[model samples]
Target: MLLELQQIIVHPGQQMLLKDISWQQLENILEEMGERRAARISYSNGWLEIMVPLAEHEKDKEIVGDLVKILLAILDVDFEPFGSTTLKNERMRQAVEPDTSFYIQNQGAVIGKNRIDLNIDPPPDLAIEIDITSRTRFDNYAILGIPELWRYQKQGLEIFLLQDGQYVKSPFSPNFPNIPIVELVNEYVPQCLTIGRSQAMRNFRSWMQENLQ
Candidate 1:
């Protein structure tokens, strides 16, 4: 026989208070439980939300890393990868944690912790989101000042490139025109777990080496 679990209702802003409990109190509770992954926290307007990854959620991170590796090997661009860092707009008093982000070398840039101080500068060159569920707003990139944003869903990949301070649908990437978004998503993401990271990377390299003419 199957058993049903009860659901608990939580108010929108109450979750953040959990973090305020003493670290020692939390540690004691955690000691009796299985290992838990760290949570990524952010404040949306005035609501606090925390993102906790499942133990088996490594596939998304692996796929993103593989994409970065493939891009670096195929293109001669310089970039650095950051995962889930807090980006803030002080003027707007908003903070966001992008799933994956990158910075191009020699660009006017500033970095922050818990919140990035944008001052008057624009966002990063690229931001990637792996969407398991629908988001409340699709215009997060615009609000964050991101120039390029890619969202990967089970249906396919959506590419939004910012132009003239607005987002537009484009067939070619403004940052890397030669790399096709759809093809990459179709080819690499589905095969991430089956082939394993090293072998998958080797296969990707071989494919790119053959096609990058």
Candidate 2:
């Protein structure tokens, strides 16, 4: 504990890993950091990583999240969005704060609840992470039993479905099997920068309506 938590500085697009951090220490650190901070964290066993996302990272996350909301609305699917909520399990000694998470099939389970306890409540049906700043740890999500995860990096979007206790890369998301999400995001997300977020979303909506049928 020589290096106090306040002394640790994680620059944008950079991350720091601390070793041998106990579960209680992690809890204390999380409490100290507070809920509104910009940094995100992941813990596995005794290892903890604190990451500060870059500006592009935030932009990417927003655009993709908007697109997801549009999809859910059009499909008339009931869902609840949890943005960067802390999901942790003390028994598993694993924790992650995703860019966004959604309760789709299990939406009713978390309604009106202020907190989500993985020990009792079901894991999010879909988890989204923008990997521009730091790579996601699949082990944490897999161990948590999240059914699906979307990872968007510089290359493009990737959809992974939990199958047989592991994430298998797939071209389509289980929730939107008829649509090609990877292609849609890659083509539309950049439009947020060029034409503005609102216009980009409108265009995406028009495209969805015209093409979905």
Candidate 3:
């Protein structure tokens, strides 16, 4: 059992890449590791990468996640938020644990699902990734077939929409069809830093209701 342990640390609170690891092996590793705050595992083509997020990474992740929630609330949209839930597809040879994920258009499909099987269940309508340190490949998410992905890095956000078996950088989110996600994140994330998350969220929601309504 000791010999089977093939872990190597590339950087503290960053990434650990392993080669020739099977899906079941990766599952075993995650199970043995148990629950960890802000830890993410990804697999593609027999290569597995484990990520341990840092403090700044989590701060940005929370800010982006909060903003999305506020926007949903403002629009009176029906959504179910799943934070850092492990998503995988053995057939696709892909897996990921997003910083935050949501079911909006597909909300009813998974309302009572205790275990999600991507082969049958629809993937998250939207997934958010905060890339302060470790970068997630768009190709991996593309393979997973998530409809929308929001990636934040260097205070900039990029929105990717899955189309025709590939990801395209889109100006707007498919989930929030009317909103410009990049502009929204840039404008409001800083306000959270200045006025605090709760206050900023409150103010943004009020503004949205007044303007959007």
Candidate 4:
């Protein structure tokens, strides 16, 4: 959604400079909730957009793929790392695109393209956001019913676990507490800008081996 401010000039002798600001909010509401939905939101100065994946996004998809491949090589799991998508709120009439998202093995049940028709439902299990700007209000995760969220900002990582319909900072995760996400992110993210994907994967593998032992 885009919002704009307008200025109108009337006559020459009778000068009239009328200043008017206009804002628009766009919402995509569904009648029945589907597997997922992706949408964008606009704010003044900056916007908070989320792309709910019918499938994974580009770089994020690649990252999740690598992580899953590495994890499967080391651990015994029958699942694969699903892609990220966007989500929306019909009741509140808001939309946001999470930076990165995923559905763990067997979590999706079914998958399709086009768009996930979410009438009203809880969001994905994990939503990742790269915080380029400080949120004027608390992050919009809770409003969308996302169970857990990982936010990266200022070279620091914060994990928020949803409890009692609200988000609370917790080191313990009900879903993948044993995964040590913080350590993995800390080690891998820095290398993202400097190294190749293969090298990063090798380093992650090495780190996992040491940690597992």
Badly placed stretches (over 4 Å) of model 4 are: 1-84, 120-122, 133-139, 209-213
The better-scoring model by lDDT among 1 and 4 is 1
lDDT of 2 by residue, 163-191 (tens): 99999999888898889889899989988
CA-lDDT, candidates in order? 0.58, 0.91, 0.81, 0.50
> Would you list the rank order by TM-score, best first?
2, 3, 1, 4
Expressed as tens digits, the lDDT of each residue in 43-98 for candidate 4 is: 22123332222222335435644664576567654432334444555554444555
Q: After superposing candidate 1, which stretches have Cα over 4 Å from the reference?
A: 1-37, 55-57, 105-115, 133-137, 163-166
Pairs with steric clashes in candidate 3: none
Question: How far in Å is the alpha carbon of 138 misplaced in model 1?
Answer: 3.3
Question: Which sections of candidate 3 miss by over 4 Å?
Answer: 1-12
Model 3 per-residue lDDT tens digits across residues 1-213: 354443644454668788999888887987876765446888888998888888878898888898888888878889888778877888988888888899999988988765566878889899999887788678888888888998998759998888897888888887777766788788778888898888877877787778788
lDDT of 1 by residue, 1-213 (tens): 632211323333223323333433333433332233244444435444545544343457558656765776577666656665556564554555666777764243544422345665556677776665324234545777787787776666778887776888666667776677678766777676687767767777777778774
Q: Once all C-alphas are superposed, what RMSD does model 3 give against the true structure?
A: 2.1
Better candidate by lDDT, 3 or 4: 3
